[model samples]
Every structure is written in C-alpha cells, then in structure tokens.
Target: MAGRRRWSTEEILDAAAELLRTSDADSFSVRKLAAALGTDSSSLYRHFRSKTELLRAVADRILLAAMDDYSPEGDWKQRITSLALHVREAFGQQPQLASVWGRHASSGTGSRLVMEEVLQALSASGLPDEDIPARYHRIAVLLAALITSEARVSTVTPEEYEQGMELFRVAVLGADPERFPALSRFAREVRPLGVDRRAAFEEILAAQLAHIEDAVHPD
Candidate 1:
C-alpha cells in the first residue's frame, strides 16, 4: 500500500505559506503545492477540489493566524488598530497571497469573526446602527487597498527600493516650475518613503477611524 497519506489541508497550507514567504510571487497551483509537499498533486485535489478552493483555504489560514494574534478587548481605536495591524503583519509575511485575498470581503469563519468585532467596535464608538455597514466597508476597503499596495512591494530588494525612490525624487525635482509649480517648489520635501512606511500608513488608518467617529459624534 502507498499508505493513507501524511499531508492534510493544514500541512498543505503550511507549505503554501512557506512558498509565499520565500518568493516574490508564488504562481500557485495544486501541482506546485503537491511537489512542495512531496506527495501527489492528486492528493491535494482530493481535499481542495480546485485551485480556487485551495486559495480560499490558504487565505482562511492566513486570516485565522491574524485573528489568533488579535487582542479583542480595548478601546475602539486600539482594537481596530490591533486588528488591522495583525492582518497587515500577516500580509507582510506572505505578500504573494494579498491578491488572492484582497478582493474577498466575506463572512467566513475568521473573517466573519473579525468583521463582527469591528462592527461591534463601531457601534460601541457611537456609529449609528444603519451607518455601521457603510463605515465598515470604507474601513475594510481602505485597509485592503493600503495593505495590498504595501504587500505588492514586499519583495523589492534594497537596491531596487533605493533606485525607485531616487527616480521618484528626480522626477519630482524635474517638474517644470511654471506648469508644476507646487510640485517643483515642494519637491525637495518629497523624500522617499524611509524606514517604517507603516508610520504613515497608521496615520491613514487613524484618520479613517477618526473620520467615522467625528461624523457620528461631532463636537
């Protein structure tokens, strides 16, 4: 007998995470995952059914990890910040999965759990009952967009990152003073995104939460 099999869905996803962490982009496929597992790709098919299912499983794994690390008890700002940061941190570790997951705003297990907690936080923070869904969408979409953008660049090497920043600065400096006066004047201040890009990102996150709060609880 070839034996039952050693790998489960959990094992497959663990290997998937490894591939995602190591590569700039994992061109994911059942066959590749199987090879990585040292088992027949057909075995993966038995559990996952298709590549889409496999991707969703991997995504669930990623989100579940984020949720496990998340602290659910805190002020709305602190709690939301914690949740968003955990998700983004997981993306940083497995950047290639961002696209697979970015568009999926769903009510599945871990995702659903996080969404409910977020809605509760909004309600607790004084968002109107009818307005929470819209606000939640706004927050979720913003996080998805920002994290997707950052994750897409997660594998940029030190040299490429520096060169890209230099090119941006050069372009800014070259903007015509007459036609692009504001940019030309401010170009010197347009420095590269230095270490800790998340400092700026967290500002946006805070602003989003604050915007929601101010709308509901304006002074």
Candidate 2:
C-alpha cells in the first residue's frame, strides 16, 4: 500500500523556504529540498510537478511576505517609497531568495498584486499617460538590481569581501587629481563609505525619487 503522505504542502513549502534562506538559492533543487525534509525526491514531485513550479511558489511566498502590514495610504511618492523599502527589507532578511529572484520570474498572484500597487502609484504620480509605463519599468528594474546586488554581497566570504573593499579603495584613492578632481578631492570622505551598502542604497533611492519628483513637478 502507498505510505501515508508524510508532508503537507505547507510543511514542504516551509522547509523549502528555510533551505533557500540558509543555502545558495541559485543552486536550490527538489532533491536537495527532499533530503532536507527527510524524504525522497519522488515525494517532493508528488506535491510539486517540478522544481520550476516549486521555485515559483517560493518566490510568490516571498512577494506576499513583503506585503505584510503594507499600507497603500499615502501620496504617490510616499506609497512607492514605502513599498520599495518594505520589499528591500523583506529580501534582506532572505538574501538567498533575493539573489535568485530574477531567475524565478514569479508572476503569480503575489507578483501581480505588487505590480498592481506600484503601477497604481506611478499612475497617480502626475506623469503623462504615455510616460508612465517607461517610468514604471525603470523603477522596477532599478529596484531589482539594487536588491539582487545587495544579496550577492551578503553571500560572499570574509576574504572575498575584504578583497573587494581593497580593490575599491585602490581605485578611489589612486585617482589622479588633475583628471579626476572630484574623486581625488573626496577620496578621504568617500573611501570610508565604500562598505556602507545601506547608505549607498538610500542615496540612490533618494536620487531616483528626486528625479521622479522632478518629472511630475518640474518647478
């Protein structure tokens, strides 16, 4: 007789998510998840038809988690900023998932809802009807890039991170004063901030928000 199903769908998903959080998301596989759950690979296939489907479900779960306690009550810029920050924090908590977000392409209900909220905010931002699509695309791509890059950095080893910082310091501090005046002049101030990813992300996000504000109200 067939053995009683040992794992519920929710149980399987929870274990899969934990695995993704604690390991390399890009290398996630059904067999590995099954092993982690103390089951055979075929057992996992009984719940999810394939690894791709499982990944989609996991990605959607992350998306929905990002929307927890999210409030849609605010001006356009406020709305976008809140959503962006919430999403970033959610991914920061699960850097492995964020690292593989682009590869998954999850367009499930959660993904659709997020897109809807952002698009609505963009429409309400006072941009011309024709420009809204392009602006939305730009914002989405930039946000994805920023979060993915942060996740990648979080996964690196101490040695690799130190090496990266050293390379950055060399490039910044070695810039010639005559040709690269600004970098040379601010090298003292900038070199120390090289490892401050949160600060860098905030600066970039602020600049993007300012540019969007300019587009809407060019005064």
Candidate 3:
C-alpha cells in the first residue's frame, strides 16, 4: 500500500467536494471524507469540531472553484445573468453539497467574492450606490433559491418521479372531473407527470430578471 499522504487544507477541501459530488446526500460523510483523505477520523477532529464544519469548508472552496467558470462578460445585465447562472450551475452540479449549503458556519472567502461581484455588477448596471446592496441581495437570493430547489427536486430519480406522477393522477386528477374541472382539464392537455422543469426554471429566471430590471430601471 502507498504511504499516507499529508493533505493540505485545500487538498482536503477538494477531496471533500469530490466526496459530495460522487456520493448521495445521506451516505457521504466526514468519516468517509477522512478515509478518502488518507487520515484517521480522529485527526480531523482537531481541525473541525463537527462534520458540518469540515463540509462547510469544503463547500466554500467549491464556491471559489465555481468562479473560474463564471465569465462575467457582456453588458451589465448579461454579466449578472451569466454570473448567476454559473453560480447556480455550480451548486446544481453537486447535489449533496447543495442540500446542506449555507446551513453551517463557514470561514471561506468564496461567498464574499460572489457577493462582491454581484454588487459590482449592479453598480455597473447604473444602479444607485445606495441601491446596489438591496438589488444584489434580491438577485443573490433568487439564484440561490432556484439552485437549491433544483438540487432538492433532482433528488428524485426519473422512475420515482413517474411513480409520483401516477400517484398524483390517481389522487387528484382522477378523483372527480366535475369537482376538479380546472385540474382535470389541464391534466387532459398535459401528461400526468410530464412537467418540464427546465421550462419552468427558464420562466422563473425570466420573471426574476424582469422584476430586478424594473427595480433598477423603473420608468
């Protein structure tokens, strides 16, 4: 067997991210993390009091890694949109990490950088200096919520979702056509469980962008 390697914090964080990306939210854990790092679980206890701490550090690094993919090019609006989508995709790429993101304490600088960039993007949009923070917060929350919800929703496998659709059809659409005319009528037009999540996401993103644009450039 190869000798145990002394992993730096960065390397450990990277490993933590790998662990999250490849494992389910329930099974991948700090013990697994330590094993992947070629160290004893007890050794990690010195640096992190709990699993949450170690994972949060890993998540923070993951956030930083995301910035490399965020171009932030184009006009102010386009730049912000690009950045938001990139950030969203970053979290979406790692479902386990997204499941617990921002819930634990963190000392990482990635969140700060993201915040700074968003605010700067707002400033470039010709938003008033005093208004940038609120606008940034609004955009940030929407992007985070969308990505987090995507992660949660994606937890269900395609087969499971189809099962759910069948259940929904029986429970609601099949209950009473007269009592649930609107739903039944809609169900007639649409498949029981064939809602396009990507389409819904695009609509939501467009609405949020329009909402923010109105706030920043109100007539």
Candidate 4:
C-alpha cells in the first residue's frame, strides 16, 4: 500500500495559486484545491489553518514570483514606480489573486520584502523623517485602490465586460442633456474613445510621484 501523500508548504502554495489562476475567486475553496492536488481537504488544512490563510499565502507566492529577484533602479520616484508597476502586472496577470489582496493583509516573506523596499524608497525620498509614514501610507492606499480596481475588471469575460461597458455608455449618453450637459458631452466624446488601462495606470503613477516630489521640493 502507498504511504500517505506529504505536501510541502511551497508545493501547496504553488498548487493553490494555479487553482486560483484558473478558477473564480468567489468559487475557490480548500476542498477544491485539495482535489486539484489529488489529496483531501485534511491535507491542506494541515498546511493552512483556514481558507483565508491559504489565500493570503497564495497571494504572497504570486507577489514573490512577480518580484522575481528584481531590485528597482534609479531615484526614489523611479524605484517606487518600478515596484508598483511590478505589483500591478502581477495582479493583472492573475486577477483572482486580487481578491486575496483586497481581503487580506500579507505578513509573509513576499509582503515583508515589498514593505521593506517601499520604506527604503520612501526614506530616500527626501521627506522629513516625521512625514515618511504618512506618505508611505498614502502611496500604499493609492496603489491598492488603483491596482485592485483594474484587477476587478480583468476577472470578467471579455464579452461580459464589453456588454457591461456598453450598458454604462448608454446610460451616460442617454442622460438628459439639459440636466447633465457636461456629462452628456463628455460621454459622447470621451467615453466612446475607450480606456488604455496601462497608460492610465502610468499617468496616475506619474501624478502620485509628482506629488511626492512636490513634498520634497515644495514651491
């Protein structure tokens, strides 16, 4: 008779991440993950105390994969921008993991490394010592909002997304022109143009970095 299957933490996380990548976040479960690994839920529970813990571990695994030994280059603005873009790319690639990110705060190696890098960048940003924490929090909140907002869009089927966008466009364009003239005009002119999410992300990052620069060299 075969002995019991033994799973390492790294193997468990890898399998969990693959399951998440291919499955809907709302429907993912430890039982499902164990089935995928050809094991029982008891095996997974031995490694992870709960589904929430498992999800957070999977998120950290993705983040570490995204970092991939990357160290940011150039000044503080450049460094933070590089880090943020790496994280955004990871979430964009595996949007189900965004749900994990949105729900849990990672205290694992991956997240700790990321936090350390960001703090170091902020320290080098020329902000007064008293101001680093606030600025760091501001940037963290902004990146989380922007990255997760885009990731949410990525989780849907393309046809579903386009259909939803069309509905939104119609609602905006159909609004009473007299009552919402500005909105009507913008909807007709700009809404139809479509959004380039990468470009938009870069633009927002630039604005945020500029604000940091301003704090350092205020007029």
Candidate 5:
C-alpha cells in the first residue's frame, strides 16, 4: 500500500503564503516551504510542478483576496475612490503579493473577475465602453504602484519614516524655488505634515479617475 500524503495542496500553499507575509519573496523556495511544512520538497511536486507554479497559485489567491464586492451605486467618484482604497489596503497587507499581482499575465480567473468588475463599474460611471479596458488597465497599474511604494515606506517606524520624508521634501523643494514655487510654498505651509500615504494616494487616484472620466465624456 502507498503511504498516505501528509499535507494537502491548500496546506502547502497556505504555508508558503505565511512565509511570504513574514519574509521576503526571495526566501520562498520550495525547499524552504516544504521544510516549514515538515515535508520534503518532493512532496510539494505532487501538488505543484515547480516553484513558479506554486508562486502563481499563491499570486492568484492573493489577488482574489484583494478584490471586494464593490457596489456600483453612490457618487461615482466616491465609489471609485473606495475601490482604489480597498485595493491599496489589501496590497499593503501583503507587499510581496502586490509584486506578484503586478506581473500576473496569465489571464487567471481571479484576475479576469477583477477586470470584469472594474470594467462594469467604469461602464456604470458613464465612461464609454470603448475606453473601459484602457482605463481599467491604467487604474490597476497606478493602484499597484502606489500600494507597493507605500508598503516599502511602511517597513520603517513612523518616526524614522517621517524624518526621511522631511529630508526628501527639503531635497525636492530645495532644487529650484522658482521652478517649483508651488511645491515649496506647500511644503512650507504643511511643514513636516506626517506622511498620510493613504490620503495622498486616494487624492491622486481620484484625480486620475476624474481625468479619465472627463476624457470619456468631455465637457
């Protein structure tokens, strides 16, 4: 009789995800995952052909978690903003997962579902059907980029991170006052305004979506 398989595919993938959450993606090797699960690497092969396939499954699971059942009702701007924020928060929770989501190209079912919901929401927002695909693509890219950038910043303590931002402000604003007068003035006015990354990202996303909306329906 064959020996019993000790771990299910879900158990293996869940272990891999836990590793991703606590460690960097580079550390997520099949050997490491198997070891963590108290199994040999060969056992993992029965469920996943290779580490790449396992990573893909992990990415799909993460992407599904990132999606929420967004309501199409409400001021379209608020609805869109809520959706963007939801994606941001979800990605923030799993920075490594965001990186995987950023490169997913296989038209996986979860990804397809996300795209469909986004397109549907855009369509309901009075955006032209023809423009939905490109708009959805842009929004996804922007949200992913913003979330990943914020996640990097979040790796540091709030106090240290604030000091770093202050340094960045000085560097950027000090470049040329005449050229960047508005930025200089704003920096002075908000001197050391703690990095509210979530708020900043929401504002940027809102503006971008507004632009897209205007383009599609041009006043």
Candidate 6:
C-alpha cells in the first residue's frame, strides 16, 4: 500500500496552486481538491488540518518559485529590480494565486524568507539601518499592489489595452501638470519604457532609496 499510495506535502500544495491559477479561492474547496488528487477529504486533513492551511501552503509554494535561486551579488539595484519583476511575473502567471497571496497575512516561511532577502538587499544600498524595514515594506507593498491591480485590468482586449494606455498617458500628463511637471513631461516616455518592468521597478526603488538617504543625511 505504501508503494501504491503517494501524497506528499509538495504534491498537495502544487496541485492546490495549479487549481488556484485557474479558479478563484472561494471555488477551491478541500473536497474538490481531494477528489482531484484521487484521495478523500479525510486524507487531506492528515496533512493540512484545514483549507486555510492548505491555501497558505499553496501560497508559500508559489512565493518560493518567485525566489528561485536568486543571487545577492552584483549591482544591488539590478538585483532588486530583477526580483520585483520575477515576483510580478509569478503573479501574472497565476492571477488567482497572486490574489490569494495579496489577501493573506503572510505567515508562511517562504514569504518571510523572500521579505528577508529583500530587506537585506535594501540594507546593502547604504540607507539608515532604522529605515530598512519601512523601506522594504513600502517596496513590497507597492509591488504587490501594482501586480494585483494590473491583473484585475489585464483581461482587456489588445486594442482596448492600447487605447487605455493612451488614455492613461493623457490623464497623467494633464492632471496637476504644475505640481507634477516632470511627470507630465515624461508621461509618454514612461509607457514605452515599462516594456522592461524590472528596470522600471528598479529605477523607482532606487529613487526611493535615494530619497531616504537624502532625508537621513542631507549635505
């Protein structure tokens, strides 16, 4: 029976994550997952206790994938930018799973590890030690928010996407031009430049870090 039966935590979480990729979390029930896994609901309880725990495991697995073998050496800005882009891609690849990630309180080991690595990278940028946590938190929150927001509007038709981008350009440029003069002047340049979202995110992050540095030690 041992040879014939096989249900590991990784397998279960992978299956659950795959389901989340295509369906809403509300629609993903333990019974349905067990049925799909060729096991009974009771069997799942042996591994995961509750549906919430199983979902947390699924989120952890996906988050780990986003952090696959990331290296910390080389340019700090580039590394962070790549990390953010990978995270964004991970979410885009699995919108439903991403939504679950954003909604959860982030109690999983994988999630915490990712945050630690991000904090370390930000700290290496020479910002105040006290500011690292808040800076890291801001970057993480922004990345997650942007990814979720994009996922929600991603169902637009190609033509509609183009039209929306055009409209966004006009709105950003026209709104409060006096206060956001630089943003207004660069609105058109911004859209096309985001083709490499990793670069864009990195640039934004670097700017934030620079701002923090200036605030802490102004010349």
Q: What TM-score goes with each of the models?
A: 0.87, 0.82, 0.80, 0.91, 0.77, 0.71
Model 6: pairs clashing at backbone N, Cα or C within 3 Å: none
Model 2 alpha-carbon drift over 4 Å, by segment: 1-4, 166-186, 192-194
Candidate 1, which ten residues in sequence have the lowest lDDT sum?
A: 19-28
lDDT over C-alpha atoms for residue 51 of model 1: 73
Candidate 1 lands at a TM-score of 0.87
Q: What are the per-residue Cα lDDT tens digits for candidate 1 across 30-132?
A: 7777887778878888787777776766766778889888778788888899898999898777778776677544335877877887888888888779998
lDDT preference between candidates 2 and 3, better one:
2
1-219: candidate 5 lDDT, tens digit per residue: 977458988888789888877766566689999888877899899998877778778877765676644454576667667767666667777776666566543245666666766777787878767878888889878876787677766656678977888798777667576887877767555644336776788788988888977886788
Clashing pairs in 2: none
Query: How many Å off is the CA of 5 in candidate 3?
Result: 4.8
Which should have the higher lDDT, number 4 or number 6? 4
Choose the strongest candidate by TM-score: 4
Per-residue lDDT tens digits for candidate 3, residues 1-219, read 986666677677777778777775467677888888779887767777888788778777657878887777887777776776676677767766876664552457887777878787778877679877777777767766776777776767789888887797687667577887877778656653235655666677768667777877789
> What ranges in model 5 sit over 4 Å off?
1-4, 68-72, 104-107, 157-194
**Candidate 4 residue lDDT tens string, 122-152:** 8998888899888888888888788778877
Give the range of the ten consecutive residues with the poorest summed lDDT in model 5: 99-108
Residue 141, candidate 3: how far off, in angstroms? Answer: 1.9
Ranking by TM-score: 4, 1, 2, 3, 5, 6
Q: Where is model 1 more than 4 Å wrong at Cα?
A: 1-6, 24-26, 103-108, 193-196
Q: After superposition, how far is residue 96 of candidate 5 from its true place, in Å?
A: 3.7
For residues 1-219, write the lDDT of model 6, one tens digit per residue: 354356898888888887776677789899998888988888889998888888877777766788885666666566676677777777777777766777663577778877887887777777778878888788778777776666656534689878877888678767687888888778767664226555665667678657766765689
1-219: candidate 2 lDDT, tens digit per residue: 977459998899899889887776657889899888778999888888988888788877778888865889889878888888888888888888886676665777778878999889988888888998888888888888998888888877899879988888899999899999999999878844337787787788778878988988999
Q: Give residue 141's error in model 6 in angstroms.
A: 1.4
